[model samples]
Target: MANPYQPIEAQILKTIDETPTIRTFVLKPEQDVPFLAGQFVELTVPGHGEAPFTPSSSHFERETIEVTIMKVGRATTALFGLKAGDSVGIRGPYGQRYPLESFEGKDIYLVGGGVGLAPLRSLFLSLVHEIDKYRRVFLRYGARTPEEIVYKYLIPQWEKLKKVDIDLSVDVGDKSWVRKVGVVTCLMDDIPCDETSSIAVVCGPPVMMKFVTFKLVDAGFKPENIYLSMETNMSCGLGQCGHCRLGPYFTCKDGPVLTWEQIKDIPEPFV
Candidate 1:
C-alpha cells in the first residue's frame, strides 16, 4: 500500500479559466493515482497547504486529472496563482463514489450550481461513456450570473448526445445572453421526477442545495433516492480529522456523496 500521508508530486499540464474566480488545473501526476468518479484528492502547494478537491476529469482516463477550484481562501488563493508546469503534491482519491449501480436503469437528473459542478462533471463524464445503460439524463446547471457559469464550452457538445436533455439558467442574465433567467430550482417544473424510477444528484451552495432538495422532494423524489455531495472541511481526506464531520459520519470517509436519507438526521449538511 502507498503511504497515505505522504504526498506525491504532480505537474500542472495546463490551466483553463472557468470563470473570473474559478480555474481548472489539469495535472499529470508522477505516478498513476487511481480513483473513482466523485472521489476527492488532497492537493498541496509546497509552502502553502493541502486542501480537498474533487477531480473534474473522468476517472476512466488515468493519464491526467483536473481539479476545478474557486478562489475562496488562503489555500485556494495559492492554488489560483499557480501557473502551468508548476508542481503540487497530491494524495488519495478518497471518499465514496456516487452509486452508479443504483442508477443503472433510472432517470438521472444532475443539478449543479457554480463550482459545485466539478464533481458532477466527473460523474457525468463517467456515465456518458456508457450512456445507453441508463434510461435518460437531464442536466440543469445554474450560476450566479451568466459570467460565472463554468463548462460553457462543453454544453453544446453535451447537448448533442442522444437521450440527454441539458439546460442552463442564471440567477440573472447579462445583456449578451438569452437563456432562461431564474434560480436552478425553477428548472424542475419542466421535467418529470417519477418517484419510483427517477433519482437526482445535487451539488451547490448550502442555500441552493437546500432549495433544490425541497424541489426534488416536492417533485416526488424520496429522501433515500436523492444523492447530495456534501463536501465540508474534509481537510485530510483520510478520516483523521473532524472538520468534515456530520453527526457520526466523516464526510471524507463515509461520503462526499451520500444519500439524503443518510444525512437527514444530522444538522443540515449545507448549513
Candidate 2:
C-alpha cells in the first residue's frame, strides 16, 4: 500500500542534558525519519517558525531520532524549555550527507570544537558499528572550557572502542579536569597522518575552522581532502529560502558539508 502523505511531526520522548548548555532530544516521528549523517532538518514550532538542526543519531538506526542542540539562539532557548511530552514539526532529513565511503581503508581524522561535535557524533557511532572497515580513526574534540564537553556520558565508552584514538582539549582548564589544556588546533600536532592516504573532517566555530584548516594543511593534508561542515542561519532545510545560500551554492541543497577545496576560493564561504 502506498502511503498518501508523509507526516512531519515528531513527539519529544526524552530530553537528556549532554552538557550544561547542550541538550539532546529523543523524538519519535509519526512516520519514519530517514537521513544520512551530516544532513540537517528544519524544526518548527507552529507560530514560532523554523530553525535548522542536525540529527545526532546514526542513519543505520532511524526508529528513533536524536538531535543535540546548544541553547545559543532564541529558537533553541524555546526548544530547551520543552518537556518530554512536547511535540515539534520537522521537515527533513535534508542536505547532502558526509561521504562515509571516502574514508574506508584510509586513515581518518575528526576535528570538532564545542557544539560542532553534534553532527560528527552520528558518524562516530556508525563507524564504531563497523570498526574494522577503516585503517585508523582519530577524534580531536575541543571545548571552550572543561564543562563544555557535550558527550560527557558517552566519551569514556567511545575512547575504549577498538582502533579509536580519542583526544580532548580545552581552551581553559579547571582544577578537576586532567587532560590537555590548549586550543583544539593544538591537538592537530599529535595526529599522525599521511596526507596521501588520509582524510580529515572538520566542524567548529568560524574562527576554529579557519585555524584548523590551516593546521591540517600545514600537516600535509590536501585542501580537497579536508571536509568542513559550514553552518549558517538556516531557515528552510529544502532551499525554499535564501538565508543559507552561499553565493552560487544553496547550502541546504548542495551541502552543509563540503570539501575545503570545493569552496576555498569563495571569498566569504561563511558570509
Candidate 3:
C-alpha cells in the first residue's frame, strides 16, 4: 500500500492574486489526486512544513488542483514566496466529504463568508456540472470588505446558469460596490428554498458559522440537513493526532464536513 504520510510532488502551473493576503495556486500533481468535494489536502512547502487546505477547484477536474490560500503563518507565508514552475508536496484528499447524493432533487443552499468560500466553490462547481440532478441552487456569500471577496471574476458566470441564484454582501462597501451591505445571515431572511426539503451547507469563520447555524435552525431547517465545514486545527490528516478533536469526533477523520445534528451538542462547535 502507498504510504499515506508520503507527499507527492506537484508543480505550480500558475498563480492568481485574489486579494492582498490571498492567492490561488494552480498545481499539476505528478499523479492524479482525486478528491470529493469538501475533502482537504496537506500542502508541504518543502523545508517550511505542511498545512492543511481544501482544494478550491472542482473535484471533477483532477488534472490540476487549485488551492486558494491566505497568508496567515509560516507555511503559507513560505508558499507565497514561491512562483510558477516551483514544486510543492501534496498529501491526502483527507477527511469526510460533503454528501452530494442526498442533495439530489432538492434545493441546495450554500452560505459562505470570506475564504470559507473556497471549499464551497468546489461543491458549487460539482453541482453545476450535474445541474440537472438537483432542483435549484442558491449561493449567498459575504466578505469583510469588497476587496476581500474571492472569485470576483467567476460570480457573473455562475449567475448566468439556469436555476442558480447568487446573493452577495460585504460588511463594508466601497463606492464601486453595489451589493447588499450586511452579514451573510442577513441573506437568510428571505431564502427561497423550502426549509423542509432543502439542504443548507455553511463554511466560514467560526463566529460566522455559529450565527449562520442559529439562523438556519431558526429558519426551520433540520439539523441533519445543515452541514458545517469545520476545518479547524487539524495536524495529522489521520485521526491519530488529537489536535482537531471535538468531543467524540476528530475533525480530521470524522469530518471537516459534519452535519449540525452531529455536532450541535458539542461545546463551542464553531470554535
lDDT measured at residue 41 in model 1 versus the true structure, 0 to 100: 90
Q: Kindly give the number of clashing pairs for every candidate.
A: 0, 0, 0
Between the candidate structures 1 and 2, which one is better when assessed by lDDT? 1
**Candidate that would win on lDDT:** 3
Runs in model 1 lying further than 4 Å from the true structure:
none
lDDT of 1 by residue, 42-113 (tens): 999888988988899998899999999999988899988899999999998899888788889888999998
Considering TM-score, where higher is better, how would the candidates rank from best to worst? Answer: 3, 1, 2
Give the Cα-based TM-score of candidate 1 against the true structure: 0.97
Residue 164 of candidate 3: its Cα lDDT?
100
TM-score of each: 0.97, 0.94, 0.98
As for lDDT, the candidate ahead, 1 or 3, is: 3
- The candidate maximizing TM-score is 3
Off by over 4 Å in 3: none
How would you encode candidate 3's per-residue C-alpha lDDT over 1-271 as one tens digit per residue?
9887899999999999998998999999999888999899999999999999999999999789999998999999999999999999998889988888999999999999999999899999999999999999999999999999999999999999999999999999999998899999878899898998899999999999999999999999999999999967888898887998888999899988899999999888876
